[model samples]
Structure formats: structure tokens, C-alpha cells
Target: MRLSPGARERLTIFWMLFPTFLVIVGFYIYPTLYNLELSFTDITLLKLRKGGDWVGLANYWEFLRSSSFFDIALNTVFWLTAVSVTCRMILGLLFALLLNASFLKRMKLSTLARLILLVPWATPPVVAVIAWRWMFDPTHGAINSWLLSTGLISDPIAFVSNLSTVWPAINTIIVWNTTPLVAISLLAALQTVPQELNEAASIDGATKFQEFRFITLPYLIPTLSVLTLMSVIWTFNNFVYVWLATGAGPGTFTNVLATEVYLKAFVDLRIGYSAAIGVTMAVVMALFGALYFRLFGVGDMQEKVG
Candidate 1:
């Protein structure tokens, strides 16, 4: 039998996408499925050669019953992810706006300014964390040295060792390392906005704030939406800043889910239980992405991008 034109087109598209589909399945879907399977078993490092016993939902139940589960979850969702994402979004937009302004172009300083802005991001995350650790050290750190000099405090304060200041310190490191990407992306988006719109708005006697609110902001909506999703997902899943900076503690006070997963699997040697936490975090992010796209309207975003 001969295929119809529409069927032929559909077949062609499917064949074109087949390689990409295989990659996604191989790298993402398969690993996620394997992790899910591992979550249900009583697997440990000792059971490497032999398959672990199937204990349906036991790991999940154990996670729910864990004493530190809520505290770690709260730290992951709010302190680590929320705080970093919020700060990144705000600072990224500000930097992008400043870089996008005509004053820099007129001053011939755009390239210089961008390169300087990239210094933090271009540095390795581990290096940035270590530098921050030194700065937060109690006795001889830069921050304490400055504060003492300014008479802000009579004594050097231990920023990292103190529970009250640890979260903020970690968040500062994350924001510094990540905000450059956000700013550059937003700057690219800002560049795509037609200058005609701004000029027209100005001719209408609109204030700078009104021009941005009316013309520029609509163009940025799609970019902002994507940045928001990326920020949440990346920050939530990130293990480096939290793990390297604090090692998940001054006695687990600043522990987040990613480090918890590592500590369980590697340190505590509870592979199955750690897989359960990984699976849970994955599910939560999936739901959040779905709800966010639903409320934000993926259709509208595509329309704007197009």
C-alpha cells in the first residue's frame, strides 16, 4: 500500500528525530528508570555483584520516617534553591539592564564591563567556594578584617561556622558563580528588542519605567520564564556549591537534598535510600515544572520567542 502525503511527511520527521530520541532515552530516561528501580530495592555497596532484594517502597517509607528529612527538604526548597534563584534573577536583570543601556555603548565600555562581570563565572566553582570559605573564616578572613577595621564588630565573627550566617554565605557564593550566565542570556534577549519601540514610546512622552513596562518587558517575558525554570532546576539539582563550601554542615544545619543524597550513598553507604531521595527530588521538580509551564503558558512563551 502507498502512504498518503501527510503520512510520508510524518514518517520523515520521525526518522529525522530518531537519533535525538535515542540519545534522550539512553542518557536520561534509562538512568532515571534505573534510579527508580534502585530506589525500590535494598541495594548497598556490598551487593554490587548480586542484585539486591526487592523491597517494594521500603526505601521510600524509610525516607519519610527519617528524622532529618523535613529539615533537609526545607533547606533544599527554600534556603538553597529559593534564595539563590531569587537573588540571581534580580541581580541578573539589573546587570543585563545596565549592560544593555546606551551609556556603556557611548562610553565604549561594553566589552570591558562584560569581561569584568564574567570574572566570577569564569572562575571554577570549587575555586570560588574556597575563596569564599577563606573570606568567611573567623580570625584572618577579609570580611572580618574589614569589619574589625571599620569598628563594625569588636571581634572577628565566624560566618561559616555560625548557623545564623551559613546559609547566606553559601547563597552568596552560588549567586556570584551563576549570575553571569543569567545576565548574558538576558542581555542577548534585551538586544532582540526593537529600538523602534523604545523610540516610539519616548516620542509619546513615556517615562523610562513606562517604556520598559509597556514595550521592553513584554519582549523579555519569554526569556524571563525560561531563566526562572532553569534557575530553579539547576540550583535545586546543584551539589557543588553546597557540598564544597560547607560539606553540608556545621553539624547538618545547612544540609540540602543533593548533599544528603551523596552523604547517604557514599558516606553512610545507603545507596537504596539515597536513590529514594534522588527520585523524590526528581518528581518534585517535574511537578513544579509542569505546574509552572501550565500556569505560565508554554504556548504564549513559544509565541513570544517565535
Candidate 2:
């Protein structure tokens, strides 16, 4: 049978997308499904030889019944992810604005500031954590040393170990390491803002904030929204900063869901429980993605200027 032109085009498109769909299924879907399976089983370090028996949500119940779950979940959702993401967004936008300012470009300070921003992001995460960890050490950290010199702090604070300072210390590390990327992303978005709009706003007696609010911000909202969603997902799933910085130290003082998952699997040797936690994180993220798309369409409509 002979095919029509439209049918041929559709077939070609499907052929083009076939490999990508296969890759997505292989890497993402397969592992997710396997993890879902693992979550239901009584899998463990020794059970590698023999497949573990299915327990049908017993692992999930165990986590729920545990007293530490509530605190760890709260720490994960609120302080580690939400607060850190919020700070990154605010600080990123601030830095992007500073870097993108017209006057700052003339002064050449933007170049130096941008270089400084890139340094942290370009550094390896492990190295960055190590540096930050040393800085936060109570006995011999630059932070405490400076505090002592300035008479700002009577006693040196154990930032990574102490309960009161741990979360903030983690937040500082996260924001410091992550915010540069956000700022740089926003800076790129800022570059797309039309100069004519800003000029017109200024010509109309609009203030700087007004220029940003009306002219620049509208241009950036699409990028900002996508970046915000990405930041949340990345921060939510992040394992490195927490693990290396404090090892969930000072007796689970800075424990988040990610660390809990790791501790349950590697340290405590409970693979099934770890899979349950990971599955939970995936579910929460899936819900967030759906809500995000509902509030702001999957992608913004691009307006073409005549």
C-alpha cells in the first residue's frame, strides 16, 4: 500500500524520536520501576544473591511509625530545600541585576564580580564542601578566627556540628555553591530584555524599580519560573553537600531525607527502607512538577515582535 505525504512525515518524526524515547525508558523509567519494586521487597545487603521477599508497604509503615521521620522530613522540606532555594532565588536575582546593570558594565566591576561568582560553581562540589567545612570548624576556622579578632563572637561556634547552626551552615554552603549558576542563568535572561523597553520606560519618567517591574521582569518571568522549578528538584534530590559537609553529624542534627536515605542503606544496611525513602522523594517531586505545570504552563508562549 502506498502512503500519503502526511503519513510519511509522521512516520519520519516517529523514527527520529524512537531512539530518544527508548533512551528515556531505559535510563529513567526502568530504574524508577525497579526502585518501586525494591521498595516493596525485603531486600538487603546479604539478599543480593537471593531476591528478597515482598513485604507490601511494611517498610513504608516502618518509616512513618519512626519518631525521627517527621523531624527529618520537616528538615528536608523546609530548611534544606525550601529555605535554601528561596535564598538562592532572591540572592541570584540580586546578583544578576548587579552584574547586568548598565552603569556597572561601564565601570568594569561586573567582570570581576562575575569571575568571583564563577569560582565557587566551577570548583568541584567535594572540594567546595571541604573548604566550607574547614571554614565552619569551631576550633580553627577562618570564620571563628575573624569573629574572635573582631570581638563579634565570645565563643567559637561549631557550625556543622551544633543543632542551632547546622542548618544555616548547610544552607550557606548550598546557597553559596548553587546561587552563582542561578545568577548566571538570570543574567543571561536579563540580556534578552529589550533595551528599547528600558529606554522607553526611562523616557516616560519611570524609576529603576519601575523599569525592572514593568519592562525587565516580564521578560524574565518565563526563565525565572523554569529555573525555580529546576532548582527545587535539584536541591530536593541533592545528596553530596549534606553527606560530605557533616555526614549528618552531631547525632543526626542536620539530617535531611537524602541523608536519612543514605544512612538507612549504607550505614544501617537497610536497602528496602532506603528504596522506600527514595520512592517517597520521587512521588513528592512528581506532585510538585504537576502543580508547577498547572500554575505555569509547561512552557510560556513566546510572543513574536513584528
Candidate 3:
């Protein structure tokens, strides 16, 4: 059957989107495929626009053989699973719940609290790193000063220089820096919850904890899942905070996959091997995404993504 004039007009509207599609295909899709192909070959920083001898899995093998590869991988996984998801979820939920409370309705007070929380978010990554690094300094830092003043410790502690404390320090900066975004998203979800449900729960003699567990928690699960996935990916790929704050110091104890890739590619000039690390990080993120989708159902996650 022949299309009507209105249908053709609608098709013309869709045709207007073709340019965006073309741009995405050319810049995003094509570059991704090129990167994948480059990962398979013995490409180097020197071979920018030329052919490289195919090396199959040699690059990956080389990466696996690196002394610090497993350490970096374990650090990445730990940060992604524990620091990123755990801290963001807990703090986001705490602030979201607090802000949604009826007693915090004074606009000036609310604004001040929100502004303070947003400081870490608004600060540039490099600047934040510098600030955090200074704070963690053993001798002259504010942290040690406060600890000494409060008698929490007898002497200054080298937060970054200590391998055991370095990851926690790095993760503290990351969690503080990124928690505002998650809090805002979760607060929006909280606001959308029906007041009637909460009121009814209260009238039925439900305690605040009970009400949250039965009413609020269920509604927040899907949003929390999406936020958790995002935090996981972002934390796994977190480089600036760890790199600048600690420089992955004490012999690279805090180096995650992203910083490892950077050190390999730029510092060591191992482009292909770094690309393999990049691919590995992507695969881990994809696995997390798959698990999230499976737990929540693909349609639900797609709805959020779309």
C-alpha cells in the first residue's frame, strides 16, 4: 500500500535524526571497532596510522604476566564492589532519607546543608585530589592536626605512604567526591514516593525503621540498582582521585585498572597492552551490567537507560 502524506511527513522527521545516527556510527562505533582491532595486533605508540603485525593474544598474555596486574585487578574489584557501591548507596540513602524528612523544611538550612554536600561534587577532580592529598599528609596536614588535638593518636600517621591505609584514603576521597550525585538521584526517587503510603504506615503504628523497610526501601530498590551499577563502573574506572591523591604510591598499592592502563600506555608506551587492560575493565563492567539486568529484569534496566 502507498503511504499517506502524514506518514511520509513523519518519516521525514525521523530522517532528521539520521545525522546524529551517522555521527555516532562514524565517531563512536567505528572508533570502538578500530580500538578492538588494534587490541588484537602488536600496535605501539610509534605506529599511529600504519599497519602492525598481528599478535593474536600476545598483548593479553603480556598483561597477564605483569607483576602488578593481579594486584591492580583485585584493587579495582574491591573498590568497585566495596567502596563505590557500598559507600555511595549507604550515604546516598542516608542523605536522601534525611532531606526528605518533614522537619528539615527550613529553606535556608536545607540549602546550606545541600551546598556543603555539593562542595566535593563541584570541585574539579585535580583540585580535589590536591586538597585531599594535603589533608592526608602526615606531619602538617589538618587530619593529623585534628587527631593530635583530639588525642586520637600520639603521633602523625602517614596515611598515603602506608600501603594498608592508601586504598582507604583513596576510596574516602572517591566516595566523598562522588556521593552528591548519587544522593541527588536517590532524593528524587524518595520525593516521588506517595505521602499517603508513609502517613498510613505511621498511623498503623509502624516505627520509622519499619516504615522505611516496608514502604520506602521497596520503592527505592530499582533506582538504587541503577545507581549502584553506575557507581561500580565509575569507581572501577576512577583514576584521577587515586592517581593524583596518592600517585598509586607505596609501590602502586592503590593502582586500579584505569590507572594501570594509563601507566602502561603513556608512561611505559605499551599501547596494545594498555588497550588489553582497557578491554578487561570493559568486560568487568559488562559483567556487572549483565548481573544487574538479570536481577532486576532487562526491561526495567532498559527503561532506566532509555
| Number of backbone-clashing residue pairs for each candidate, in the order shown | 0, 0, 0
- 74-184 in candidate 1: lDDT tens per residue? 999999988899999999999999999899999999999999999998999999999999998888799999999999999888888889989999999999998999999
For model 2, residues 1-306, the per-residue Cα lDDT tens digits are 989999999999999999999999999999999999999988987786887899999999998899998889888889888999999999999999999987888998888989998998898889889999999888989999999889999999988888888889989988998899999999999999889888988999999899989888988888788788899999988889998988987788778889999999888878988999999999999999899887775444232111
Candidate number of the best lDDT = 1
- Across 1-306, the per-residue lDDT of candidate 3 in tens digits comes to 888999999999889989999999999888878877878887777786786778988888888898887788787787534766697789988987877766777554776677787888898888877888899899889999999999999988899898777878877877788888888888888987898998999999999899899999888887888888777777777778777876666777777788888887888877877888888777878897888789888888787655
Ordered list by lDDT, greatest first: 1, 2, 3
- Candidate 1, superposed: residue stretches over 4 Å from native: 1-18, 304-306
lDDT, residue 134, candidate 3? 93
Model 1 poorest ten-residue lDDT run: 297-306
| lDDT values for all models | 0.92, 0.89, 0.81
lDDT of 1 at 30: 99
Is candidate 1 or 3 superior in lDDT?
1
lDDT for 86 (candidate 2): 98
Off by over 4 Å in 3: 1-14, 49-51, 106-108, 303-306
